[model samples]
Target: MKTTFQHVNYYWDKKKEKDLKNDQIELFLYRSNILGKDLRITNYGGGNTSCKTIEKDPLTNEEVEVMWVKGSGGDIGTLTRQGIAGLYTKRLRDLKKVYKGLHDEDRMVSLFNHCIYDLNSKAPSIDTPLHGLLPFKHIDHLHPDALIAIAAAKDGEKIVKEIWGDTMGWVPWQRPGFDLALQLEKCLNDNPGIRGIVLGSHGLFTWGDTSYECYINSLEVIETASEYIHQKIKKNNTVFGGEKIQSLSKKERLEKAALLAPVLRGLCSSENQMIGHFTDNDAVMEFINSNDLLRLAPMGTSCPDHFLRTKIQPLVLDLETNEDISNTGDIVKKLTPSFEKYRQEYKEYYEQCKHKNSPAMRDPNPVIIIYPGIGMFSFAKNKQTARVASEFYINAINVMKGAEAISEYTSLPRQEAFDIEYWLLEEAKLQRMPKEKPLSRKIALVTGAGGGIGKAIADKLVKEGANVIFADIVENRLREATKSYNKDIGSYILCDVTKEEDIKNALNKTCLDYGGIDIVIHSAGLAISNPIEQTSREDWDTLQNVLVKGQFELIKQAVSVMRKQQLGGNIVSIASKNGLVSGPNNVGYGTAKAAQQHMVRLLAAELAKDKIRVNTVNPDGVIIGSKIWEGDWAEGRAKTYGIDVKDLPAHYAKRNLLNEIIYPEDIANGVFALVAILHKSTGNSINVDGGMASAFVR
Candidate 1:
């Protein structure tokens, strides 16, 4: 017998009918946060919820009713008052009827103008009417993975009918907004006793007379689905055979193991412990070790919300032939074939789906795949990404196994998945915000841009909408980095900042090519260690020439260019926290950097007449392996300190409140702040240290 969904209407107990306390509101918000983080249910600005706020209309001499729904770009996990946009119920319903057939953009603008809520809000949720359509005071809509898993199958309609029964109605997937709402309205009219709705390839909708009841109803529907599938798919799990574990000798392996502890820790750390559990679990191992890998293919996640917690897919590893599970060997040799096969298959799928609306192929990076016999691997910029991929893999595993047991589990045509995976509209959705908003239309010049902090600062400026000329002594490295950036966003310039003639030529060439420079980030410096006892006079000359004198020569020439162009400019020098707090090994560099910061303040005050604002960013212990962190410096510093090189990243990263390592990118973001805020205020030194040095932080 197929299990059916049953809706139980809940009400506040008479004894507990009093209004919720402040703590209760926070508790509710926290749960909302969990749901938002999981992406198992919601996405960027995709879902909405509202609480009834009744207030008296002073002029009208009557009570008014409204619901404050979340605004655009708001995620429930990080919601604030600014995220909510108030709407008058009477006016909203009236517009919903008359607003039929308008383009979504037009409909949205009309709603924004007419809605008697907050006038300052940008855009209301696309499902505003659906939430309003329910008579209940509280409403929630999420695309649950379990629900979508059952919804996307060949027998989905039958299974959903049997499970949900008459509690709710199901509508095949339609594009969201007016069309979806129209279909939903018709379904509700046809089934007056309907408790809620399930949208195919979308998500679930639930509501109640109160907020708690609505939340519980949403939870119950999925919990029952999970139980039904779990019972149906339970198997006699067994471990499959793979390569036997090979033990390495203590001395060498210990060094390698220590080198790998950070990657391992990242995989098994807090916020990512779920990956450790999934990889170590027997079912996942057996699944990976299977001869027929497709049999264990992940069922698509239960809902859209899972995407944030669980990426769109997981890697299916072939454990027997897998390499680099330890992250030591050539990953290229191990993953090359798999990468090629994925790309070939992906290209064919794109050809099959080549409609005018089809998008170009995205990076062939397989979000999830098995390494023949190894468990799995997930990819993201950070741990949160891996966590999301792991969750999707687990949920998909359960769904695929359950559906296969019931009947042949049918996968969506690879083309349909391609259409979604490479959808232009979906990609366009991400283009909603520019990567560099703070530095729009700004032109930047970065010294020492061939490596380390200079390169990082240049990249940061380019990300912030600044057209950058990355100046450095190494012409080849400068040109090599230019390939990674859009030609329109950045370019390379070879100039020795310490040479006044080289500085003048580079600035003149840049201004001639790209109009005028609006910002400059000076990061060129040379480091030499000699205790006062062993110090040499020549070492001081090189340090002064690169650190203090270099910036001064560049700024003097840049200011002359700025004055001729009649435009205000901003300059940011990358000084060190070591310049402020004394470190034992420093001899000459710190003194040079200390003088550089003071020069910045003096220049900021003098340049006020020319509208040029000067500031300096001081960062502490930024290292290589980052675009800005040089591997040589890390090794040199480690040798100098007489400690393991691997330990230095953690050593430097932990000297802060957050106990996180600082990156050159962190320092780059500081440059962005100086340029962004300098239009309003000038002549300030902003410390990007992990709280190591405290001067005025304006």
Candidate 2:
């Protein structure tokens, strides 16, 4: 009989499996990748899969059994050969004789290194023994939301019996380690012919003689559990005690989210600056708008992985339906007390649960925050971490949904949650992480980032680890410019700097996309060179609008977000040497450049109290790799200098004192020095014109 599934997908393909039939490890990777493709099956970096293979022993010249399992901190969806750890099954089983008791389980983790079958293998995860000790050749351990929902239900054991009778076994809550592995062994041995076991308040485990059987067994168990929960949900009249408030329109929710994100990001980043992520998908909106939110939110999450990323509980913003969310001051006034209360409570939780050997208290700020009628906001050290945290919380919501649909939902005990959160093993893994880049937590917005100098500045910032938003007036240019970058690090938006609405929209998008802005680069401009007799009113206005007024509007809108974040910021304008030098046929462009230069000085002095630094980088004759020079500006300048357009680069280069040519990259370096290196100095112009004496600031 064929079993169809409504909740989980069966992605196995015989043709694909045949290609890797000869290689055991390759088949293991294929199975793991397919299972991890769906978040409902396993969230990012949450689950583990293992296979025992016979490999030649390099030292003995004989075959030995080696258990290959997902290494510590590796995500199964993106797992590679390097991401798997190999250990001798014999050595792992030998440790069972040395095990003193459950209290001494941590010592076994350190001993796992001694069993390494491959010297180059990654460090083994804590769950290594869980797979090694099991008799099956292939095993799968996953924290699927549907299965965890069954595991976390109050009557989880009874429900397990109803679903599979004696065909599956049940084990009570035990933190993953040597003890849990032992319990699983006992359960499987005690219940013969059982295909899997449901770990109470944790997850599910399944095993088989082959990789395909193991994969199919895991799917069957999860699919059955998901169908059971789906039927119960259909029978219920409402979920989460019915929604307490209607959801806001998509436009309203995003507008409110944009305004609230920076303030929340600033408050959460008091100890260390954070990048932000916002999600208003159906899952988040349903949970936040539910009547059960106040009751269930503080109960916290059950799965250790969920609790690790999303903390013990989220901070719930008790926003009333009548409250004015658009008023920034009102939002701040109401949220301040709630933030303070959350911090104080978090500190108390640490005091109550901490052991003498526990690590020092971490930042007390909440990682996840829920705003009713709006959406959820998550913050972390970088954009990806923040986004993943949001995804994990949504998984937690799903687990709760399934549990509450059948029986009362249950969370992990407070002390157990604390033990997992501050475990020494987790701390050691964190210490091994590489140091962050100089601009790791910073966010940047680069106008005119479609190409040339602007694109170069955006690339430099992203290289230094900042999440950048590329803003330009042209759509195709924006798409083409951002194509080469990692989608996570760089994003693009069409923006005309001359319009105030465009500037405002771009800044709002920046806050929504990456939390808030820390660095702003105004490089968008158009040049119009003309003699006094030929200069038109239209030509003068266009230059001023793009070069001067555009810079003014971008800075004006961006500063509000910076101030709200209270993290301080940097503003760099790519002005020109013509701003300082008196050049021919440059009446309109020169005046606009000069205005841009002085505006930096004025803003630097005005925004000093807010710790916002404003500066300028001036470059001249950047003829190669510049869009500005590709147009009329080059021809007009060449005409005035009595040279052909092709000779403009050489003519301009020879005139400089060093006879060096300036490129867009040189201008980018000047901006980098101002923002990344010269932190203490501002209101100064750095000339990158190859030692042009006339452009030097006196």
Over 501-563, each residue of candidate 2 has an lDDT whose tens digit, in order, gives 999899989999999999999999888888988999999999999999999999998998998
Residues 63-105 of candidate 1 have per-residue lDDT tens digits of: 7777666665566757666666777777776766566463453
Candidate 2, superposed: residue stretches over 4 Å from native: 1-4
User: What lDDT would candidate 1 get against the real structure?
Assistant: 0.61
Superposition error at 575 for model 1 (Å): 14
Q: How many angstroms is residue 309 displaced in model 1 relative to the true structure, after the best TM-score fit? A: 9.1
Tell me the spans in candidate 1 whose CA falls farther than 4 Å from its real position.
Answer: 1-31, 34-48, 52-65, 90-116, 235-287, 290-292, 296-334, 354-361, 381-390, 405-428, 434-698
The prediction achieving the highest lDDT against the true structure is 2
